[model samples]
Target: MKAVVITSPGGPDVLQLQQVNDPQIKDDEVLIKVAATAVNRADTNQRQGKYPPPKGASEHLGLECSGTIEAVGSRVSRWKIGDQVCALLSGGGYAEKVAVPAAQVFPVPDGISLTDAAAFPEVACTVWSTIFMTSRLSPGESLLVHGGSSGIGTFAIQIAKHLGIRVLITAGSEEKLAACRDLGADVCINYKSEDFVARVKEETDGKGVDVILDCLGASYFQRNLDSLNFDGRLFIIGLMGGAKAEMNLPTLFAKRLTVQAAGLRYRTPENKAAIVKEVEKNVWPAIAAGKVKPIVSKVFPFSVAAEAHKLIESSQHIGKILLVPS
Candidate 1:
């Protein structure tokens, strides 16, 4: 098997494709012949040695992939050999083959290509688990998404809008904001020139949004709190702006706000399976109905994984970037 190897803790240049042993599946897992894998910010962090794979997970870079089932374990019943599926992986999506728990695998939505199905698992599970499952973001409410043009942000906007939630997003550029608007974002704020907290409040009629999905952790923490309505929920998934922050306890007390953070990679397989099930039940329908779609910015062959990483780090791409095995 061939996979992208991180030679050292550094930039995208550290990624190198090389031959490796094919993964062995456990009794409850299945082997996927990778068709495509999506690049994520966490992959970059892992390459830089900032985020290590969870214990017993594949040390490779990819977190999600779409592929054909080459083999299924004895304990796996729902999936069979030759099933075309996409899976939520803990790691090791950057290879020709990966072993994953069968429970985390999903049937590709009707009308979606097998390759593009690679874009859904990570972003879908991340958004669904955090805001909808935990924060309980319901219809007729307003939600704000930070990094509006990102993979997670793009998916979040469409799904939220489909569910009747008013969507507001913050992006750094007008082009990015325009993309968000076309994807159903009702309010778009350019963080480079305007204040998102003020804009969020303004769009919600000064009451603030009912929920906020933030990736810029520390730099936007306090401001996120200020931009939330009373009893609002703020879910943080990444710390791109740094991890440490000083929070005003009074704000939480005054507004009865809830601040929470989580990552999909380190979760127990059982937990991830539950989230995957919910995504299949809720999100897949929207996708099949053409209400939600995969927003792929670019596709790179596995040999050029570093270039894909560079594109993601540059924040120039509007949606998910994919890597396919050559």
Candidate 2:
């Protein structure tokens, strides 16, 4: 088997494609011959030695992949050999083969190719868990997603709109803002030029948003608190801005807000499996019906995974970036 390994904690240049032994599967796991995998910010952080995979997880740079089942473990009854599937993984996606728990694998949704399916799991689970399940965002309630043009942001907008939620989002450029608006975002704030808190407040006539899905941790912390309506929930899944920030207890108490920060990579397998199952149930129908779809920014050959990492670091892409095995 061939996989991308981080030679050192640094930049994209540290990634090296090296031959490694084939993975041995547990009784509840399946061996997948990977067709494609997608990039995420976590992959970059791993390369830079910032975020480490959970104990006993693959130490590779990918978090999700779409693949074909080459072999199934004895205890795996839900899937069989040759089943085409997409999986939410805890690492080791940047490879030709990966052994994954059967519970975390899902049948590719209708109207999607195996290659494109690689981009779905991580973002789907993250957005669904944070915005819908955790925050309980409902129809007619306004929700704000930071990084509106990102892979998660793009998926969040479509899903929220499909569920009849009013979506407000922030992006870095007009080009990105236009792209998000086309995806059904009610208000698109250019974070580079405008104050998103003000934009969101004005859009809601000072009522503030019911939910905020944030990626910039501390950098936007105070402002995020200020932008939420009473009883609003703010979920943070990424910390691109910085990890530590001061919180305003006065604003928090006054707004009656809930603030939470979370990540998927370190979650227990059972926890991840539950999230995957719910995503397959709740989000899949919309995808199967063509009401929602993945936005792929680019696809690169897996042998050049380093190039893919470079692109992700550049942060110029509007949606998911996929890496296909060469």
Candidate 3:
């Protein structure tokens, strides 16, 4: 099988497509003949040698993919050969074939194309596990999402709006802000020109949002705390803005806030399986009903995996970018 290989710790140019051994499946895993894989910020980080795949995971770049099941292990019962499915992968989605735990695979939602289904698993599981599952963002509450035009942000806005949550988002440009509004964001603030903390407070009548999903870690940490309501929950999933930050302990004490940081790639298989199950149960219905949809910005063939990485790093695309096997 051909897979994108990171030749060194550097820029997108480091990614090269080359022949590699096809991944082997364990007794509880399935082998997916990759139809499509989505590019993510983490993939770029991995290419730069900042984030390595978890122990025992595939060395390839992709974190999620949609494909046909070519083979299923004896321990896998829910899926069969020839099932069209998308899966949440720990790594290795960049290859033509990947081995994944059967429990992380999902049936493509009705009305969604098999290729587009590749965009859902990672963003869906990330948002669902962090905001809804851990933060307990319920209906009738207000939520703020950073990088509003991103894959995670786009999906978060639609799902939160569908569940009756008022959505506010921060993006870098007017075009990005407009896209977020069209996707059900009630408040769109340009992080480049405006103060998001002030805008968040203004939109919430000075009380602040009930929850905040932030990817810019240290740079936005204090501001994020100031933008949260009493008893607010803040979930940090990425550290794009650097990782070190000094927090004001008084703020936490005064507001009774909760701050947490987690990612899906390093989680135990059982934990990922549980999150995948919850996503299938709660989020899939919204997608099937046409309330939530995949937002694909572009698609690149596997031969141009380097270009896909470049596009994601440029941050010019508004949603997920996909790569199909060449």
Worst 10 residues of 2 by lDDT: 195-204
Error of 3 at 186 (Å): 0.2
Candidate 1, superposed: residue stretches over 4 Å from native: none
| Cα-based TM-score, every candidate | 0.99, 0.98, 0.99
- What lDDT does each candidate get? 0.96, 0.91, 0.96
For model 2, how does the per-residue alpha-carbon lDDT over 1-326 read when each residue is reduced to its tens digit?
Answer: 88888989998888888898888899999999999999999989888898899899888778999999999999999999999999999988999999999999999999999999998999999998888888899998999999999999999999999999999999988889999999999899988899887888888889899999999999999999899999999999988899899987999889789998788988888899999989999999999998888899999987788899888788899999999877
Per-residue lDDT tens digits for candidate 1, residues 208-227, read 99999999999999999999
lDDT of 3 by residue, 212-287 (tens): 9999999999999999999999999999998999999999999999999999899999999999999999999999
Which model, 1 or 2, shows the larger lDDT?
1
User: lDDT (0-100) at residue 63 of candidate 3?
Assistant: 96
Report model 1's TM-score to 2 decimal places. Answer: 0.99
How would the candidate models be sorted by lDDT, starting from the highest? 3, 1, 2
